[model samples]
Target: MSELASGVQVVRGEMQPWSDQATPHPALAALLTDVVPANRRTLILGPHAPQQIESVLAHSADVTILVRSVADAQQLGEDFGPCLQVIAGALDGLQGEPYDVIIATDGLDRVLGYDSSDLSWTERLGALAGLAAPDAVVVLALENEFSLLNLLDSRPADERHGDDEWRPLHDDPTRPVSVDQLKAALPWRAEVYADFGSRTFVRADVAAAARPGELPTRLATAALESVDVPLLSPAAEGVDSACRAGLLGSIPTGWVAIAGAGATRDVYTQTGEAVLTADQNLTGWDVTITGDATPAFDPAVVPTTVPSGVSVETVLFRLAAAEDVPAFRKLAADLGEWATTSRVILRWDDVIFDGESFAYGVSPWVTEEPVDKEDLLAAAWSRFQDRLIGQHRRHPWPPWMLGDDLVSAWLGMSGIEPPEQLQATSPDTAPAAAVQVARGKELAAALGVLLETRTDTVDVRTALAEAEEAKQELFELKGHVYGLERTLGFRNKAMKTRENRIRELRGQLQRLTTAHERIRGSRTYAVSRVIFHAAQVRKPKTVARKVARRIRKR
Candidate 1:
């Protein structure tokens, strides 16, 4: 793959390979040698042979190498060493930048481990395409054998295996993905590179060829000429695989008309006349006509002539959805040339009978209401601020009043009496209210000098000072709470330590009680207790002899 950069317009080449091949594919070599212009940057991805990279690097010192790791770069040697850059992880890291050309050999299939779903492959390939500049090229080298073989292998056996006997086969390391599978996963145009062994390559220009109904006759001819195989260029038969496979429908042509009572029949007729006169190719075929009023319009009024060499089949019908005036207007707009060519007239009998005239040919006339400059100004002024005194008292006043004199005059007009304490309150509250009013008036004026100005700075400053004082009080309260939290932190730590010590003591006491109970139940403890009582009795021997003598006397 290759592309020419902006400034110097130099072409660059790129090649990707999975296996350690000494020689790149002949088709790839040819593309690199032929397509790449001189003095531009080139990039190569995957674990390609060092010699192959060296060959391209010798031709252009601006070559860059993207590998899986630092070790891979080191192994590639001096030719690729300086230009080598590790991709870090997945292809996601390479997004967000433009590349002149991207060449993915087997890397697209090999980079992501074997996944049953084709989502990762599709997404990565799309990202690769996005990374390229508009005119840049993307080349994918795929193996056809791997794909065909895999397809054959995936077929079910004659007899299904029992649950105990079921087993899955390991993917062969030599083959990562099939060409057909990768092509199916891509969004752009692709074709198999039959000349280059099992490799398949897709160019960006080829992929984006032409959109639906946008193909030029010349390009369409070229596309058809290029198709030499079935399923490769299905567009040769006026159907791409996407359409043949039922993924998309053929481009729609013909005409549909929508007209209603409120629709602009004159505009529609004029537009249709313009299209018929302008386009030459749309001559004789029956123009499908539909619509409640469309069929009623005389076809003789519709312009039949067209410019030379233009061919189009006309199908005119009124769509149910286009019954409303707005819907009809939108449909006409979307129809573009068709709406311009086919005259579909709509009539408003009620409006005509009433003799009502629209200001403009279209709906929503600008001159519907008479303009009153004085009322407009008055309305605008009222929204700004309501003056509380003089003629302008309670009158809408803008934020930035014109001037003090103007304010006085407005006050007179509004019948508002200036406050007696105006001078006294001027410092504390007047400026603030004046500023608020002034700001609104200033915005309303928007560069137009409207509304009266008033000076109340002194009163406003006093009010601001009072607000500042209150704010300071609140700040002090917050500081006090912060101090309380600090004190609590120290107390909390002390309590925690005391609680832990108490817990430890309780555990030790419980262990001691358990040990004492075990000792009490042991045979050794019982014997020791009996011996101690016997010793005490021996000590009482004297007392016992006395007791025996007393018994004999009895």
Candidate 2:
């Protein structure tokens, strides 16, 4: 077999030991062994033998154990040999990472030198729950008998162990608490299991049982039994008292029986005798009685007259009885008038009636009377009319309130202007029709405004049309200006080129004229020289030579 299987067998054997040996309660052993899987993180609280720690370690390899003292945890480690992580400090050490399972053995009730005045078991349990993951479970193994004893012991004791030492014991006997008190201290939805032989109680799902007074001892016991777990003996006297007080009954389907003043023997006998002497049905019902230990019924306690103004309490009370009681219907009318003049607050208790009795108090003959069909129908109509009128006055034209035919007549009677549609129907409809009439007028007013705005919008459209035409004309003019600017730029460039060409031609003509003048001057001078030389040479052979010679010499 595998090591885990072998370890589990060993642990199981240790739990149930030889028949003669004193073993831990079977339920408790099963709980500790079955709750966590092997190799899971577990936090064990309280004092236990090294063998107990070894047994848990044998089944699970990973375990973080906690104990009240360092010596105890050290001794456990010496035996378990490094397989244990022991925390030796306050329970506050349990605050960080959420553990898979938190096992609290006997240590839950043991608080060392700490003030428990502000620290209740419920609060501590909540603190433990906070350390668990959402799906994590916290197992608290409390001694069942010790629970009651601890409650009583938590009061006071005279013994002195040290300055911080406190005695967990009480002197008062009348204040003894039962398992119910412990159950009341748990949060809602927590499961409580009792190991009668070991005198131990296991609280699972601590988070579920956090609400005060929601879990009763009997319910807790029942829950345990549903899981096939056993519980210690119940408090018979307490159960009897609850039954006698009418707080307990057979399991009800979809509803529960509520205790009333009539359930008590004294109240039933005295009040029933007084009211039932006039009716025969009182003896037939045989209603339960209740005791009134107070002094004789005082007339001063009952109000002789109602106040003038309307009260919500009185209104609701009368409304509740309006169908069956004529006096209640009359009171309702009076209350409606008063409500118009005053403010009122309603208390639920004042309006709720006992299902069996029509009378105000408990009595056998106080059975509810059959409703007067005709009176109820009339009252319903009257009250509805009154309520409608009141609502109309309060809110004549709520934004969502539509004016119908009924509202039209009401507005007409109230001298309010009705819408055209409602005005046409006003003569034929009832006064209660005002609600619809007012709504119609409001709708008409809104529509009229919408229509007027629509008409004005047409005029605005005409002006917008003119403005759009002007904008188009402006855009056309801008396009023309842009075209002109481009043309002017091209024309300016052409003019610049023509001016450059004219300047170049004028320069060339000036150079040519200078060259021609020089050439002409040279040619004229050479020809004149040639003619003078020839004349001088030819004139030397004749008489003319003298003139020529003179000319040549000159």
Candidate 3:
């Protein structure tokens, strides 16, 4: 290994300008801690999360990480001190002693760099296996191109490519497509996980998941919930359908293969400090909880028997999808009566029914406080209502009925009194009401995200018609503006005419006043004014004498 100035060694090949990094997952790290052996030569290939590297370091002192991006190598070198040997090169060029523990949990796609030759999946797998020792524990995660997540993704092929995928070998005919094929391709006995990077991991080919109400089915459903981008359809529905078809293992988000021992658990599902496990019995499964956790419903009410039969959620989904209003109504009524009488908070997906009665599934969530009968019933139906609308599932009810109204209709059909249209005034219902309000806000935000996935393209003719209508509107607007301008011009002309007429009238009045003043100031006009004054003062004779005297003076 030739050490470079940047503190990372260049094993072989040239370093490229790649900057993509994998996200850290705590659950995946924990699983690695269990599978990766201690005090052995380990090689971590590709860009793995720092948490994963840290987990491996906790078990083993000598660890080497290979990454194509020089920046990634520098960062890993800085983050993990001198103990970790960071190599900056392509996977094919790296020559080293065989590793007893080989981890490529981020998969083989990112192992190639910009200057590397395009290698097929089978070639990459062979190269990876060749790097491993005879008794090495190889932990590899392979992404399924035809996973439910990929199948339900609304993004087109052209839009799905990222910069890190310089040349994606997706159409490799020799690569293993399914878990069964992947297991067969492995050289050693391997345990493959279905949901590898998720919060839960399950054995890919667990036969119990084929049944609808089995523990693996619930685990798969919960694990497959969309935490990232919105899917074209509900992942829960896909899981249920796949389970019924005995193909749940065929389309996992990804497969994690642990070859050559060290895997102790078939399923590893944990939330906070709580961990859930299942042991298969003759009939079904016996679930055991390790840590202290509360059920979503009241924990005080525990079922004496194990949960069996299909989930209420699945039944409701089928009825709504089939538009079987009667069956749905009956189920709603049964659920409402049971919840109201029990006065327990319940989630539809966590409750199972074996035809005779309902039992709580192995959900360990808890409500903040106990709720009223109406609140309990409303919450359950409201959750169902959200999934129905959020997933765009078809139902017999009118599309117009939505939100609180649809929830109320379901409650009414359940033979229970619908909740009052008033805020929670009493202190007794305040805590539960607050919880419901917060849940509603969260559900609304989630629903908004789901609705944004709709990629309905505008029809060509429709787009043309809309454009034409907009053009016509623009033409009409321009004409209206022109008419207004004409009217304004006419008004301006009339105003100018009136102004000119007023100026002419002022000129004529000025001329007439000047002529009258000139006539009034004349001497003959003064003499006539004096005569008229004398005639008005005397009688007719006195007026004649005054007129004669005035005439003589003139």
Candidate 4:
């Protein structure tokens, strides 16, 4: 035995919380349940062990953790017990027992300095390659280099890890590899699976079955962080199609490559998990799944919560039975066509049952609630739009681009023709009426341009250009006026300060005059004046001499 193996200490610390969550990472959980079989002896190669250890151990399969650190080996051993044997110091440290599956969630090139072994990345893979049975599949996770998210919001290179793998613009030796590199590194031909979070857990076949651009990719920004920016940006548009074109390299946040085995029946075991839902489409409500349970779910019955003004109601409804059940059941039975009859806006919540779960017929009379809700919503949206307009009115209006896009979109919709301009009357308008009001403005602007273009071909373009220029000038003028108004406010404040200062000076002058009068009225002032006049009279002879000098100078 090697000197390093002699001191095979145990890795300590609880490794249970990783898979304990009600929603485990869908990819990681799927990889264990689907790709890694229940009967095979598996080898987990890691520097720092994966959080999905419990998911792997859940199958009650024989498992071994390959590590170069005695501490890691010891801690993992202590947490997982003797069934999970840990090999210390090297990949080849284990005697020639063939592993049915060799899996690594950590990328192949990540540092593996456990117990300070001098193994290069390629060398470790070679040893890992040596241990696998000829038919044994090698599954490893790597960052997909050409993911669409890479073109979108990018994080700092050094900071990106597994989740933020679609960062780094430059080729990082330490980072996840391209599909070609991953394929080249393995001993046999590789089958690649586009993976979200770069975790090699979900079956590639499952990921592929999703619609193009439908593969899950997360934004670099958080929900709170993206308040000013919508979840859908220019980069986000038609991403489904782009991903579908190159499903292997373009769309997945990361990828899983299986060298020995392709996607087979065993690969789809992780059909439903909570984390799988994290990649759901950006929709107002959840689940657009079709099909009636007993027969076929009618597409017409699905409730599509459309905007207030639009006339479409596709919300899904289910009918509960003669018996009360705690969980929801599909109304695909006798009531499927009945619910679509539109007697009442039926929904899961709307389907009220008695305490005994007895079925009730659809309501005979419909309430005016939907219309009332529309009115309330319109009022609220008008208030919100007013607030936005007020804020932007002082600043430059959001790029004419928003207005331009709105004009095109509203005009394209059938049966919308507004006058030259729209005037909103919020007091009496229904809630749905607010959307129409906005549409009126956008359509009016569009029609104005369309009319101008058709009226005179020669100068219409020039006139329209001038009109756009004038509109931009008006925006600038508004901004300038707003600045001047702010300055006027300051001037008013300063004028108030000046008036107070003048009053203070007037009071000081009044006090000084009153003090002088008091001195002049006193006997001391009269006596001093008389004495001073007499002194001047005595100096008259000196005055005569002064008068003679004055005459001589003249």
lDDT of 4: 0.44
lDDT against the true structure, per candidate, is: 0.35, 0.37, 0.73, 0.44
Q: What order do you get sorting by TM-score, best first? A: 3, 4, 2, 1
lDDT of 2 by residue, 378-442 (tens): 22233333333322222233434433433333233323343344335656664533443343344
lDDT of 4 by residue, 1-554 (tens): 44234334323221211211112354455545555667678877764334467777775478876655455556666777766766654444555678888877655543233233555456666767788898887777665556555534334445445531221124445343565566676677777665543332334544444432121211111111212211222332334355345443435556667777534321211211222212222332122222232211233333432111100110111111122222221222222222222322232222323222212211122323232222222222233233233222221223553432432322222222333434547766544333545533443333233212122222233355568999999999999999999999999999999999999999999999999999999999999998888677867788789999999999
- How far out, in Å, is residue 538 in model 4? 75
Clashes of each: 59, 25, 1, 23
User: Model 3: how large is the Cα RMSD against the reference?
Assistant: 11.3
lDDT of 3 by residue, 108-136 (tens): 88887666777898888888988999999
Compare candidates 1 and 2 on TM-score and give the better one: 2
TM-score of each: 0.26, 0.28, 0.69, 0.45
The candidate scoring highest on TM-score is: 3
Please, what are the lDDT tens digits per residue for candidate 1 over residues 1-554?
Answer: 21212111111211122223333433234334333434445555545555445445555556555543333334454343445433422344444457564555444543331222333444655756666666554555543332212222322443323432212232434332433344555544444332112121222222233232211211222223232222211232232322234321112111111111011111011111111111112322121212222322233442232112111100011221123434333432332212111122211100011112211011011111332322222222333222222112222335355454343433334333333444454456664334433533433343122111222222233355568989998999999999999999999999999999999999999999999999999999999998888677755778789899999999
Ranking 2 against 3 by TM-score, winner = 3
Comparing 3 and 4 by lDDT, which wins?
A: 3
Query: RMSD (Cα, Å) of candidate 1?
Result: 34.9
Give candidate 1 regions above 4 Å deviation.
1-27, 58-61, 77-79, 83-88, 112-119, 145-192, 195-554
- Candidate 1: C-alpha lDDT: 0.35
